[model samples]
Every structure is written in structure tokens, then in C-alpha cells.
Target: MESLFSTMIVLLLVSLSCFTSSEALKSNKGNITIKWDLISWTPDGYVATVTAYNYQKQRSIPSPGWTMSWSWTSKEVIWSIVGAQTTEQGDCSMYNENMPHSCSSKPTLVDLLPSTPFNQQIANCCKGGVLKPGLESAFQIAVGNAGDSVKTVRMPVNFMFTAPKQQYVCGPTKNVRPTRFITADKRRVTRALMTWNITCVFHKAT
Candidate 1:
């Protein structure tokens, strides 16, 4: 009876620790707060500070042809068809009237920076959990040119940290990137590791 009681006590302590090992992120710009229970999961290193991600995408995969595999149907992601868009390239050196190629078959998906009447909140544990300056400093993702007929564009959102990067690299290398990933209903997020490097700084309300 004493052994069983001790085990229960231990479990109780663990549970308490799980909930209390906490961290939070407060927007420097806005007063909104992002809370995290770091005990269950947290960043690699430790520091006491607040940080935030503007947004994050949960990644998941369904069985092949789970619901028309060709179409993007997973509801786990916050997707917007025909998002705001712009063109930075591919205007063609000059118009080709003879063979005016119709690349309109592909869907042009654009990712818009999160804007809310209220600020969007992200949960980063400690100072270490913070992402990049340009990420929080400036809009992380913006603009795409998907073709017509492809009414929907699969926006790239990834789980994990997006390390500060200046140039684009190919494939899943350990670093920050505009990711092309999907999240399923099961919540098994893919390792589309996106990261940002921001040293969490805390300021109390005056």
C-alpha cells in the first residue's frame, strides 16, 4: 500500500511539473500574450524571456487518396484560396503572341501575412524559443503567382523553427524556409522545421 501511494505521489508531482514548467511570449508591439507549457515540450536551450511566431502551420498526411489525393483537403491547415498576390518575375522578356503559352493550368497560391483586427499571437517558450528579426520585424511570407484553373494554391507552412536564412536552398536541410507541407487531422505534424532567431525580450506594462 505504501509503494502504491508513493507511486501516486510521484505521478502527481510529475503532473504538477508538467503544467508549471511554463513560459510565455508577449508581443512587444501589441499587449497580446502567447503562453506555452514548456515542461511537456520546449526549445533545446534555456533562457527566461518572451517570444512569438507570427504564425505556424501544423503538418499532417492522410492515406494516399484519402479524399481525392490530388486536391488539398486537409482542414488542419488554415488555407485561403486566391490569397493576395503579386508578381516579382516571369513577365517574359517580351510577349510571345505566336505561342502565347498558357501556363494558366497551375494554381497560383499566395501567402499573406497574418493581419487581424487584433494581433495574431504565437506561443514561444523562452528567449531561446524566439524566431527571426525579419520574421517578426517584417512580414515572413508574402506573394505567389499560381496559374489559373488551379484555383487553389497549397500554401507552404511548416512545423519547427525556420533558422535565419538569406538565400533559398533545396530540400529538407536543417534551416528556415518557406515550406510546402500539409497537416492532417490526426495532428501528426511533419518535420517541416521552420525556425527564427529572436532573443526574447520582456517588457512589463507600464
Candidate 2:
């Protein structure tokens, strides 16, 4: 009889533990995500598009916009960018001329203003980092001194996302299937060379 009673108590504790663990997982589910798609390989490195999506039903990222920062796992530089630009051009003194956009191992990027010239614009870009619920913003980047192929490329780490009075916790990047796109004429289809995703969950400030 005592053995039976002890078994019941252990089972109850296990059930409660399972329930709490399940709830914690649900609460950690991401509401925002960033995706990086390697569009094509360059002679020196590659060109890719980075997009941020806000999946929250009612939340939005307002003006002065989102700022994202990450540390390259290897010696990488931003040769050029479109639709958005890095906040600083870290010491390109090594290059004599035609310097890269940013040389910082850890770079911060922000969206361009709406008044940006038409020639400098790309689809879903230049919104000044103002993201609406269920919408996305994207920017293209030319990375230099990095791997030209998927096997050699390294993913950035320590991704930090910031918005007005909001905090987001970003998860480690996960390599995913390539992204596919249909031509404007709908006659041809193409896919990215590689793709990865980083999800961020909004945590209310205490």
C-alpha cells in the first residue's frame, strides 16, 4: 500500500514537470525571423539578401527603425550593400582605394530612408527600418573575403536585434533549404545557392 502511494506522487510530479516544460517551450516560440539567402556566388565571396519579418499580429517596429548587429565567424567584409547600409565603415585603411562598405568584424546595419534615390532601391527595402505587423524588410549585401561556396561559408553569430522600447532574443542560425523564386514572366524558376534562418522572440521588458 505504501509503495502504491509513493508511485502516485512521483507520477503527479512528472505530469506537472511535463506541463511546465511544454508551456516554457510555447512561450519561447519566435514571433519574428530573419532569413539570409545566398543569391549568387561572386568571384571573391557572394551576394545575399537578408530579410526581417515581423509575424506579430499587432506589434510593429516604428521609426529610426530596427538595428541588427552580428559578429562574423570569420574574416568577412561588406563590399557593398543596397536598400540598407551599415552604420559605420570600420577601418578600411588596409585598402588603398575602392574601399569596402564596412570592415568591422561586428557590424551594425539599418535601413535607408524612404527618400533614397530610386537607383539605390530594391524590392521591400528602404523603409527606414519601420516594419509593420505581418510585413517584412530586406536588403542586399555583397560580402567580400568570405567563402564563395556553401561548404566554406561560415554563419555570423551573436545576432542582436533592437527596436524602440522592445527586446528581442535571437536564436542561433539554422541552415535551411534554398529559397526558390519564379521569374516575373512566370516562365522560369530559380533558387538561391544557400539559405539560413534566425528567429527572434519578443520578450516584454520587466
Candidate 3:
């Protein structure tokens, strides 16, 4: 009778362990991460890279999409996107042509693979992503709210990340290995602050 009781206790412990493990997987779903790296500034604008990674364990699949929003605190300066490039180049886009301030797109799809780090370079309002002295002065006057002068301007840029998509198996209802898209927590976003030293030159009061 004692042997039988020991076997029953072992079965009960196994069942509890399985249940706890399943709950842990469910709790890890929205742990995706994104950040800015490799930021180098130019007179025109800065070139930097943004990267996103999947931290979900059970769903271990690449993210379907991610987005970034740009806004600034400088009342005297304006920020714009000159261009951008992604790791999966064609898989992403600044789809909102009307509002290039924000960029959003889905990445290439694959099966049973760790998520690819989505990378992009954000450029300022300079031609060919370069800001020369003369061009820099022009951009300042065009976007700057403060009067033109030989003053040092610091533009603090804020990048807000949002709308992350997680890819996972949809089960037998679709196919042998069907992937589906699910919205993730918008609160899982990250931000970057960049300041540009813009020199504004204006003609003297004649």
C-alpha cells in the first residue's frame, strides 16, 4: 500500500509542474524589446540605427512588424526624415508618405527561427543625408521658430516606438505550419533623445 501511495504522489507532482510551466510561457508573451544604437551626427542630420528583438520564449518566431514615431521638444527647430534603410531592406517602409515623421512595416516571414533584429537609419532634412554649413543654415531658417542669428541651437528629438507584431503558429485550423499575427502591448516602446548643434547665420541688421 505504501508503494502505491508513493506512485500517486509522484503523478500529482508531475501534473503541478506541467501546469506551472505553461503559465510561465503565457506570461512571457509581450516581452519584445527595441532600442537605438550607433548614433553619429552630421551638420545636416545624424545617421543612427534602431534595433528590435523578440524576447518571447514559447512563441520563438520573428516579429511581423514594428513602428517608430518622431517628435521634437525644440520650439526653434523642426525634424524630418531624409531617408531610412532596414536590415531586411524591402521588407519595411515609411508607408505613410503624407506623414514621413513615423515609419511602420512588416518584416519577412520564416518558420521556427529566432526573431531578426530590425534595423533602420534615420536621416535628417539634408540632401543625401549630409548637412553642410550653408545647407544647415538654410534648414535652420526654414524650420526654426527662433529668429535667424549666429546662435547655437540644440534640437532634442524624441523617438517613440509602437505597434509591435508577434508571429506564432495558428494551429491545425489553417495548415501544418500556419503563422498568425497578434497585436502586442503598445506600452513596450522605447525612446531616444538626440540633440543637433545647429549654427544659424543671419545677415546683420543693415
Output the number of the TM-score-best candidate. 2
Candidate 2 stretches greater than 4 Å from native: 1-30
The better candidate by TM-score, 1 or 2, is 2
> Model 3: per-residue lDDT, tens digit, 60-102?
3223323333333433322232233222323114343432232
Residue 24 lDDT (model 2): 36
Residue 115's lDDT within candidate 2 is 97
User: What TM-score goes with each of the models?
Assistant: 0.19, 0.85, 0.27
Q: Better model by lDDT, 1 or 3?
A: 3
lDDT of 2 by residue, 1-206 (tens): 99999999999999987665445335634477899999988888999999999987878899989999999988899999999999999989999988999999999999999999988988999998999988999999999888888788888888888898887777778899988999999999999999989877776542
Quote the lDDT for 4 in model 1. 100
Ordered list by TM-score, greatest first: 2, 3, 1
Q: Is candidate 1 or candidate 2 better by lDDT?
A: 2
TM-score of 1: 0.19
lDDT of 1 by residue, 1-206 (tens): 99999999999999865444222233233211111111111121111111233332221111110000011122211111121222222233343443222122222322233342223322221122233332321111211232111123222222122222211111121223423334666655443223323222222211
lDDT for position 70 in model 2: 92
| Residue pair clashes in candidate 2 | none
Please give me the total number of clashing residue pairs in predicted model 1: 18
